[model samples]
Target: MRAGGTSELKQPSEEVQQLLETVKTELEEKMERKLDKFLLVSYKTQVVAGTNYFAKIDIGGEELVHLRVYKNLQGEVSLHSHQHPKTREEDIQYF
Candidate 1:
């Protein structure tokens, strides 16, 4: 096909190609950041079901606070404002 042809063989303009490339690059960076954050949180946090986490949430007007359950390195579950940690078996109610 001839250069800059008007047929189906024609290629996209430089401006369009650059815009697409920029968007792809931006999306990749954004996803990478999000994945990193998720990995960090997952490694340092416990995997509790959605229902368990939602049940602890206390929403008061514009203020929003999440109540997340975390397990220690020794596999002990704990609740906020509690002095002592409880064993996994004792934390069934949170999950």
Candidate 2:
């Protein structure tokens, strides 16, 4: 997994690095846009019967996307992404 903080960006393992590269390439190809820089944040990992990894990717401030990567016992890997939800405040009226 990869994470960014005040100190510096933590380096991800070789496998994670490769996965990120693949994701970037796929996004570029599908979107037909060049991705300049990516900021990875809120990286977390969970291990059990399988491995689950999650993180958020900031693409040049234009968009923030959520990433979910999973690896199963059979060594199968799955990557999925979705648009991050925006936070908003609204007045609440209780009945």
Candidate 3:
């Protein structure tokens, strides 16, 4: 489509592909926590004006922690932490 007759082909190199594979594997391993009691808040949707995400994790039988992830106006992902402690009088809510 250019003035020159030759055309340029774009293909990912093997080394680049291998590096991407390695990074993917590392992310998977880190996301898969071995500990029994832990919460993971992953921003599923891309950072936008009004992106919403929800996550729930139960430490013990009664300990429940629910998190809501959202994107601020600046397009930054913000995690809102909500904790329901067994003995605490009031639930904790913090960013």
Candidate 4:
């Protein structure tokens, strides 16, 4: 990856999974819908003062979303943004 470019998609790491789990409720609230049976398909990352996680989420059925979750240097995690109704063919990118 370049100085400020995003990394390629990788399987969610243990740390990534924990970060998502830590912010699940916040994410659902932001989307204004429950995320039941959601799968963490893949993710890309951009490192800055904090790390931006662009993740492809499979929320069952045809409902998919790409979430930009940020984890700061302080280890705080939050849902930054999201693109909904994404397809399996869509590549995860910065939002």
lDDT of each: 0.26, 0.52, 0.37, 0.84
| Model 3 poorest 10 in a row by lDDT | 1-10
| lDDT value, candidate 3, whole model | 0.37
Candidate 3 regions with alpha-carbon error over 4 angstroms:
1-36, 40-48, 72-75, 86-95
Candidate 1 on 32-95: residue-level lDDT in tens? Answer: 5321111100101223331111111112223222223333456444333211122212221322
Clashing pairs in 3: none
Clashes of each: 0, 0, 0, 0
lDDT, residue 38, model 4: 65
Judged by lDDT relative to the true structure, which candidate is superior, 3 or 4?
4
For TM-score, candidate 2 versus 4, the one ahead is: 4
- Per-residue lDDT tens digits for candidate 4, residues 1-95, read 98999997898677677677676787788888888856788899999999998988788898878888889999888888888889989988778
The local lDDT score (0 to 100) that residue 5 gets in candidate 2 is 15
Question: Order of candidates by TM-score, top first?
Answer: 4, 2, 3, 1
TM-score of each: 0.18, 0.51, 0.31, 0.89
Which model scores highest in TM-score? 4
Candidate 1 RMSD to the correct structure: 24.7
Q: Residue by residue across 1-95, what tens digits does model 2's lDDT show?
A: 23331212334465565655556766566557787865564445556456655655666655655566666788666665444432112111111
Error of 3 at 22 (Å): 21
